[model samples]
Target: MRLALAAALVFAGIDHWLTPERYLPMMPDYLPWHLPLVLFTGTCEIAGALGLLLPRTRRLAAALLALYFVCVFPANLHNALNGLTVDGLPQEQWYYWLRLPFQPLIILWTLYAGGLLPRRATAVAAA
Candidate 1:
């Protein structure tokens, strides 16, 4: 799960750089320097993703990545609220609405994958 999450983040970060305009609509109008912000967040994502691979940095990376998800949530909300489309692709309101609840799941996943969460072990019965 940890490796998968890392790969996903790396892919997403790359996407931000490769097609930044696709993310522009998600940015709130009040935010300044949209392009730079996108690049910065993208870089952070990539860095965090790489950090996750190292045992010493996994916890910090997980925490930061989880926070990143929280920080960017408004953009997700903005996309949903404004009925924004990506690359001229129309997305139904339900699609965006469904995504809102998944943010927390992603956070939890990161924590668990990073070993920051307490693990429960099942007791084995004596044979």
Candidate 2:
């Protein structure tokens, strides 16, 4: 799982860098500085990938990453609603559908694998 998350983040970082204009449409037009937002997000993803590789800071790393995903959901929703197209990522239309559910699943898996959450077991009454 750690390997998977790290690999995904690294790849995603590269993708974001290569196609920042694509992300621009995702952000609100009112925002003045889109370039920083793009680079900042990319850097965070790379840092998150590195963070997930270690054991000591795993929980915080996963939490930060989870929050990151949650934050971008609105942009995805915007794309889906407007039927907008983004450069570099041609499949943006379908990506919204693919991206929505995976966020929670990723977060859940990260937390569960990190043992950050308490386990629940069913108890039975002895006769």
Best of the candidates, lDDT: 1
Best by TM-score: 1
Give one digit per residue, the lDDT tens place, for model 1 in 16-109: 8999998888899989999999998899889989989999999999999999999999998998889886674557778887888999999999
lDDT against true structure, model 2:
0.77
Query: What is candidate 2's lDDT per residue for 51-79, written digit by digit as tens?
Result: 88888877788888878888877777777
- Residue pairs of candidate 2 with colliding backbone atoms: none
TM per candidate comes to 0.92, 0.78
Clashing pairs in 1: none
| Backbone clashes, candidate 1 | 0
RMSD of 1: 1.7
> How high is the CA lDDT of each candidate model?
0.90, 0.77
Candidate 2 regions off by >4 Å? Answer: 88-94, 118-127
Off by more than 4 A, model 1: 88-90
What is candidate 1's CA lDDT for residue 18? 94
Give the Å error, residue 57, model 1: 0.3
